[model samples]
Target: MVAENSTPHLHSAVEPRQTFRRALDMAARAAMPSLFVMFCAILLSAPFGIPGQAQLQFGIAMCTVWFWAYSRPRSMPALAVFLCGLVVEIFSFGPPGTVLLSLLVIYGVAHHWRYGLSRLGFIAGWLIFSIFAVLASFFQWALVCLHAVALLSPAPGLFQAALTIGIYPSLTALFVWGRRTFANPDQA
Candidate 1:
């Protein structure tokens, strides 16, 4: 209370509580992208109106996670992508190792071809990967058919594949917009 003539020290007078609040804000911002991804997967996978439709839609989560890795390869490490895919596989009732293997393979291919993929811009790259995802799904289905005595039908599976491809571009666009608007600068 003795600053009548002397210049006031603005930052020096700031309370520790304000600094703590600012830190919390920064931390929350940094965490939002991962939180969003987790939320999207859980929400989309939750038991819904149609089970077959739900199964098909689950691929969108995998697509989003893969696209994030593709778009920001330097930040989203291979290990993280693999781990995330493993978690997805556990939640998804498909072949034990198939989804995880496919995801990693997709990630690797996407990474190797990223320079060209990036040059094609967002939607084009997304469509390319969507085609790859459908092909990979069909390959996995073929393996399942070979192993199972009952024989898995390809018709429903192919329909699911087509549905996934049809929805992929729009979902990828949503993720791209989210990444641009909500992702942390440092996280990417």
Candidate 2:
């Protein structure tokens, strides 16, 4: 009877090892594909003109990253997303908080919907992102109106806001598809 009880303990000990081994295997399977996707993101983002289209470019990156966040919330850590946004902001011409705030807001929205990522998940995400972008643009325009930077009309900013909304859903779909098909078999 003591040996039978001890056998159960031994089995429990062995079970965790099996679970750990499976997790390691899954992680190893995921690694190469994740690296490839990261490479593609950097490669595509690197050559784009910065200042002239910085806002639009940032929007595109935000959409892309948000899509990825939905796809693999566990894999793409928040700090990495923030750092990516930081790099884009520094290289592009923008006020420091612009990308950071936008990315942070998008991250929050995406994480909130982490469990429901689907074929139309990109569309849903874009709607949430559009709301944040509108608010951010409005605040920035208000600052400009108040001469926080320079007095400016809100019209052009509104136009850009509309454009961001228009483009985000499709761009998100593209990025989401790229992540799904290439990121890993399980994720796919």
Candidate 3:
């Protein structure tokens, strides 16, 4: 538990500059994991002569969003998610606003249900993520259909959702390690 005595500096109005600096430091520390995931999405989405490379990157992006939101809501703030979504959209070459909207929806749902899922095991988390995957895919498919001015087939989205679900367990374990490694000392 955090000691009350350790936070006295935050209450002192006389040291406003120092308080701001400390707060900035705290924000940077909190953002590291999410930022790393964003960087990975950008790097992995590039053409690397591998089949299904985009699909892999897409799975990673989705899994990262879900894992961070479910495990560390405070660190995975809405602003970060929004910005990451923008970068992801550019990298994935998706319809404008689609990625941002999807990320926001997933983050919102996970943040709201954090407490409810806190006591559940890995299977429950996986199930929740599966549901979000389907919804997010549908949202993207609808966006694509509207953008193309035609009713598009849902096969691509369905394939992506399946791929995401298939890779989630590995990604979750990796993020769990990342959280432990990069987490604040107190949290660790």
List TM-score per model, in order: 0.71, 0.63, 0.79
All candidates: CA RMSD (Å): 7.5, 6.3, 5.5
Best by lDDT: 3
Q: How many Å off is the CA of 150 in candidate 1?
A: 4.7
| Better-scoring candidate (lDDT), 1 or 3 | 3
Give me the runs in candidate 3 sitting further than 4 Å from their true place: 1-29, 185-188
Clashes of each: 0, 0, 0
lDDT of 1 at 185: 46
Q: For candidate 1, lDDT tens digit of each residue in 106-165? A: 778878887787678766776777777778778778778877855777886677667767
Candidate number achieving the greatest TM-score relative to the actual structure: 3
What stretches of model 1 exceed 4 Å from their correct place?
A: 1-37, 51-54, 121-123, 186-188
lDDT of 2 by residue, 55-145 (tens): 5655566665666677677555677677666666656554556666777777777777777645554456567678877876786577556
Query: What order do you get sorting by lDDT, best first?
Result: 3, 1, 2
Model 2 / residue 148 / CA error / Å: 3.4
Model 2 RMSD in Å is 6.3
